[model samples]
Target: MLNQIIELVADELNLDSKTLTKETRLQEDLNVDSLDVVELVMKLEEEFNIEVTDEQAASLKTIEDILNFVEANK
Candidate 1:
């Protein structure tokens, strides 16, 4: 699940998945802007078949945050 999330995020951001770590920040470390995050959430929803609420989306600050959310919701 973590690997899938990393791959999904990397694809969304056009980055190398190997470069991302659990500590990587979605905005600061990955350089993802607000619009990118929205798109990322949409993609994640589509990929995982789960809906992430606005509050949940807002809480996804790091790679670990995303992994935890997917793990809990998936």
Candidate 2:
């Protein structure tokens, strides 16, 4: 699941797949801005068949945060 999310984000952001990892910063390393984060989250929800509340979404600060959310909700 983590690998899948990384691939999705990498594809969406036009980033090199090798550059993304557990410790990679979404904003700094992936260059994801606010809009990108929203879009990515939406993509994730679609992919995972889950919904992320706005407050929960706002709290996502890392790749692990996303993975944990998806795991917990699904």
Candidate 3:
């Protein structure tokens, strides 16, 4: 599941998957701005068939956060 999420995000961000890790910060490491995060959240929702609350989206500081959220909610 983690790998799948990585692939999904990598594809969405047009990033090299090799550069991503659980510790990678979407904003700090990937340079993902607010708009990018918003779109990514939408993609994640569609991919995982889960709803991410605004609070949860704000708290997703790292790749692991996303993984954990999806694991818990999906």
Clashes of each: 0, 0, 0
Q: Per-residue alpha-carbon lDDT of model 2 for 1-74, expressed as tens digits?
A: 88997888788788877788877778776677889888988998999999988899888877888888899999
The digit string of per-residue lDDT tens for model 1 on 1-74 reads 78898899999999999999889999888778889989999999999999998888999999999999989998
Ranking by TM-score: 3, 1, 2
- lDDT rank order: 3, 1, 2
Off by over 4 Å in 3: none
Candidate number with greatest lDDT: 3
Worst 10 residues of 2 by lDDT: 22-31
lDDT of model 2 at position 58? 83
Q: Model 3: what TM-score?
A: 0.96
Better of 1 and 2 by TM-score: 1
Candidate 1's clash total is 0
Query: Which segments of candidate 1 are over 4 A away from where they belong?
Result: none
Query: Clashing pairs in model 3?
Result: none
